[model samples]
Target: MHPIALAILLTPLGLLLRLYAILPQGKPTKRGVRLVSEPCKLGMFLGSGGHTTEALTLLSSLDFARYSPRTYIVSCGDTLSAKKAVALESLKASEILAYSVITIPRARRVHQSLLTTPLTSMQSLATCVYHITLSPLITGVHFADVLLLNGPGTCVIVCIAVYINRFLGLHSPKLVYVESFARVRRLSLSGKILRFFVDRFVVQWPELAAADSKAEYRGWLV
Candidate 1:
């Protein structure tokens, strides 16, 4: 290689090597990165019976084992799918179960669960959890509660939960939430406002339109 070209190439490499050497080996990893790369987590879903389907689909399709995740379906729908009912059991015994068929027979509504279940019990079981919410949920008052009661948005809540774990003298845990793709023709001011807050400040692309932010285009799903 030409001397000039060689120097140019070596210069960047030298600087990177120097940086690696200078950064202390004992220097703590960022709380965020540590949590995901080697997580001790409990996955929690925060939606109705519909979310149960999405979570199962995600588990079956995604690289969930990478996170070494475990899940708990917070029954917040009217109908709970705890175990197969007699009809489903009969179908299963006959070897007629559909691959897409789920056997749980109970469903939960979100408000009812939140109002009735013990947050303390859940917190004890999970260090961190993934919360999944659907779009239709934004129309209800529960939407406001999630934004405010949880941690502004899903990502933030998870991140905050990690910090909370730290404060409680526990190791960081991974937090993940599944939100739907955006396709809203008409949005309420509150909905738009919630989206803007998320858009102006988040690591990933905003899933909704925001006047103050440009949306990022993720390539088509293969």
Candidate 2:
């Protein structure tokens, strides 16, 4: 992983985690303390996909309703109404009192645009860790390319998710990647190199359903 990516990811998390330790205790503190633990600030990286619905459905199995995440990087493969996209996101954020999400009009590659794009202060993690401050989901799905399943944008997305987790005084997010075997392997050589630097890899549904039977899907994650 690039140092810029790590710096971007860690700087905020370290500061927030420190302050959270000293802040006045409240109802939020009555939650877990692990990185993205239940009742903690759980983070998610939204990649473009048709199975996004399934992904979200599977994520519902977790205790997000307990910890209450700060944001969901909503990325889509095609041009869809921002209103619809937002409505879809509202499913996850509707219950939270404080939340913010931004949709980018055009961003074919998440790595080049999203990571490089500047996030407003309101989008950053301030209220998630410190209840007195509350904020909205900072989301960006500017590109509708859906070009590569796990492209640089995915890398940037993961990097940003980790960064937000670290910045908002929360723990690193546990990623769950759900996609077809072909899509998973479509990643470019450089992209594969970057993916290697990520924390961990997980494949869901069809991608790994038959992984044990076939060698192709065995290392599909890396």
Candidate 3:
């Protein structure tokens, strides 16, 4: 094998190792936190319908002024979610130009064939990567300081895109995953998969939290 080829192959492994080294280890803890003097760049994925409702409910409790310059990523064709986001910002009275809604291809559509899902999923990741990295340059919204995600298939793609950001040495966002309020006894598929990746894994039910060592019970955050 050529030396150049070997180096190329080894480079990705090195990057992966670097990313893994920075990931939070073991169970998560509740800690005191101070509010940032400067407004944080917030990123959130609205999965549409119920997911959107739960996520917005959680955001309603936050001081929008403190988490200014929000980026709401919605699935393609999800105008409702985008509208809801705008409505929420209006209610919060955030700065007029404080938020942007970006649409990315969905990982899988309803009734999408299993065989074709991977192709669409890849497309979703590609779009996500483009938006996460290049959109900032065009729109002036740098990669989010904090990314909040809740259940549904598309959120997983966003998580992977964030991982890719870290692998490429970009300043990755702090990933926070909130399990759905409806998931009481067990972790949802998205929650189970994201548990290992997210910086914070929150479950609304105590039993769900107890079942997963990494999950934190936050008492129904929707």
Candidate 4:
């Protein structure tokens, strides 16, 4: 069987493992509660193009002191997002806090042949697993205290990885999913999937929020 097919077939096992980790004996960590009183690590997913712009704009409204040790995740080959993240880091530099940027394989390579999509998707999944598990080992941080994400294909994979991580009792980051301003009428595909798992689901339009009672109307983010 193809590797992608194998991965897909094993997804049910992964879900079962996740459920096992969440059972009464698992002792899952609580969400939204800070593990420590000190400033915590913040992980932000920066997608290319419009997604990057909207994420940076939302960053401007956040209090840096509360979300220090910020780590920006950018898609590989997305130089624009990397450059913007670096610029934001420079502007927010402080002796007491730190900012870093990391790159991961994009879920879909630009202009990739349709026949190669499954392989690329598997590659993306491997990248997500590495960054979620091993990356933290190297960085000395188990996980981000809060993971802020917006609409993007990459965001969906990362959020799933986060959920899996939490299920394994590795970490419990408060996921905040914000729908892009462009999504005024309905949640984007990424937003819709993340809404079911994220701690907070926010929409820029009142109509979108009204349609999904679980989602909060946070006005325009960009």
Candidate with better lDDT, 1 vs 2: 2
Using TM-score as the yardstick, the better of models 2 and 3 is 3
Clashes of 2: 17
Per-residue lDDT of model 1, residues 1-222, tens digit only: 999999999989976675454332332323433434553323434233444344444444433324333334333232343332223234334343321221111222235455534453344224323222222134321111111111212223333433333344333333333333223333333233333322222112233434324233242211
lDDT of 4 by residue, 121-165 (tens): 667777877777666767866668888999688788788777667
Q: Record all residue pairs in model 3 with backbone atoms less than 3 Å apart, i.e. clashing.
A: none
CA shift of 36, model 3, Å: 4.3
Q: Per-residue CA lDDT of candidate 2, range 16-70, in tens?
A: 7775553323222233345543344444433445334443444455454454433
Between the candidate structures 1 and 4, which one is better when assessed by TM-score? 4
Best by TM-score: 3
Q: Over all chains combined, what TM-score does candidate 4 have?
A: 0.81
TM-score: which is higher, 1 or 3? 3
Compared with the true structure, the alpha-carbon lDDT of candidate 3 equals 0.87
Clash number by candidate, in order: 15, 17, 0, 0
Give the clash total for candidate 1.
Answer: 15
RMSD of 4: 5.6
Q: Provide C-alpha RMSD values for all models, in order.
A: 17.4, 12.1, 2.7, 5.6
**lDDT against the true structure, each candidate:** 0.33, 0.39, 0.87, 0.78
